[model samples]
Target: MKLIHAELIKLASLLSAWIAAGLATILPAAVAVLNSRSQVSRGIDAGFQDLAPGVIGAIVIGVVAVSSEYLVEGAESGGGRQITTSLTAVASRSRFLLAKAAAVAVTVALLALLSSAITLTTTSLTDETVSVGTADLPRVAGVTAYWILTALLASGITLVTRSGIVPLTFCIVNMSVVSVSFLLTKLTSWANYLPDLAGMHLFLRDVHGSVDIAPLTGGLVMGLWVVVVAGIGFIVFRRRDA
Candidate 1:
């Protein structure tokens, strides 16, 4: 409990978390508002599509949470990295990593929920024709789950690299409006199985040029990716020097 609380406090103290949260809340609504004015048909899954921009915020949350620990406070003063301090205090790498993961998961989940709610409400208000049916409730839930999973994925990758730049750049670029994965899907069918693309199938009603998997199956595939990557990260963190 102490470890988890400490991890939470450490995360809360970072400016990146607040910035990510703010972006997560505002970006989606702004996109929805702009989308409402356009007559172009964004297909049946427009709500989820409109909320896509907010995923960047979740990615940032995950990357920064793990990467911040590796940053040097003052190299000249020999302050060392926060990871050293964290490990010294906890004295158990596994426990500390788990605590950090738990803190990030909880924080990202709350951010996802709030951002999803805001985006959904704004989209509905702006475009009355956009109606969500009873069957779509599961997809709405899937959106939140997808955001959480993406955040975890980022966190795990950051742990392995011990640097935010690489993971952040790759994730953000791969998930952008004209994503490389999406483009590659046109040339190769296997590209659809990429983590981001497969995960998006969980909530997307009409995905273009991708494998057609059930929502539950899509979520499972994405979850499996997170598990594998995060497991590897945990192992490396345990064996490597702080």
Candidate 2:
């Protein structure tokens, strides 16, 4: 509990984390408003598309959580790293990893919840074509899970890479207008199974290609990917010197 609390404190103190939260909360709502004002087509899934890029915030949060620990201070500060102090404080690698992951999960989940509410509200108000209602609740809940899983994957990848540059850039590029997954889908149906693409099935009814995956199945596939990635990260973290 203390370890988790300490990790939460560390996350709270990070300017990047706070910036991520603000970006996560605002981007979707702003997009939704713009799309609505532009009078987007009255499709059932019109506004939901705006929520996609907002996951960038979750990715940033996850990356920084792990990357910050490895950052070495300047020579004036004795060129020390936070990971050394963190490991010294908590001898149990398993507990420390769990605490760090838990903190990221909780923080991302809350941020997702807030972003969903604001974005959905903006969509409902600005886009008179679609009214937010009871039917939208499940999708709202799913986004929280989606963002949490995304954040975990980011953190796990950071653990394996030991730097944010690769995972962060890869993920941000994939979330951009021309996504690798989207491009891959043009060549093969299997691309739908990618973690980000598969997870979109949870909250999105209109998905890529003719592949029809149930929401539950989408969640499961994403979860399996997380387990695999996080497992590898755990093994590496336990075996490697901090």
Candidate 3:
């Protein structure tokens, strides 16, 4: 228990982690509120239903949280040697990783919950006649899932690359863009099978019947990605020097 707590503290000690988390939760929420007002004037009573764009910045947060660990150096900053020494003191790598993952999950989930609440509340306040209900639950869950997957992938990539900025760049430019477009067509079996494409279906449920992929299929695809990425990350973390 002490070790886990220490690991959590270590993860939180970085300035980037807190900054990323703050931006992830706050910026999107602020935009969601603004979008609600604009949508109202456009005869679109949907409110912040289209605030997904604000969440793109969240991927950067998820990536930076784990990557920042590699940058610490020397006694004052808890260098690479300190990490290995701490692992020895802690007695188990799995437990350390678990604690780190737990912190990541908790942070991302909280941020997502806040963002969703803002979106829902803003939409309701703006659309006098429109009432947002629990129907948004699935979409909210999809966003949460996206956040978790992003964190897991980022942590694993950071472990392998050891450069926070590099993995963050890939996540921002490649993963975000690629995932957004994974379900554009159904021509190939593999295209929709990708994780983001699958998860995106849940968010696009309003048009799932007309779209190439079904919501259930999208959920399944995202699930597979989560499992695969997490499994790989766990294996790598267990073997790495850390």
List CA RMSD, all candidates.
1.7, 1.2, 3.7
Question: What lDDT tens digits, residue by residue, belong to model 2 across residues 29-130?
Answer: 888888887744847676667787789999999999999999997899799999999999999999999999999999998988888888888888887778
TM-score to native of every candidate shown: 0.94, 0.97, 0.77
lDDT of 1: 0.86
Task: Tell me which residue pairs clash in candidate 1.
Answer: none
Kindly provide the TM-score of model 2 when superposed on the true structure, using C-alpha atoms: 0.97
Q: In candidate 2, which residue pairs clash?
A: none
lDDT measured at residue 156 in model 1 versus the true structure, 0 to 100: 96
* Candidate 3 per-residue lDDT over residues 30-58, each given as its tens digit: 66566656644523225334445444545
Instruction: Report every candidate's CA lDDT.
Output: 0.86, 0.89, 0.63
Best by lDDT: 2
**What stretches of model 1 exceed 4 Å from their correct place?**
75-78, 133-135
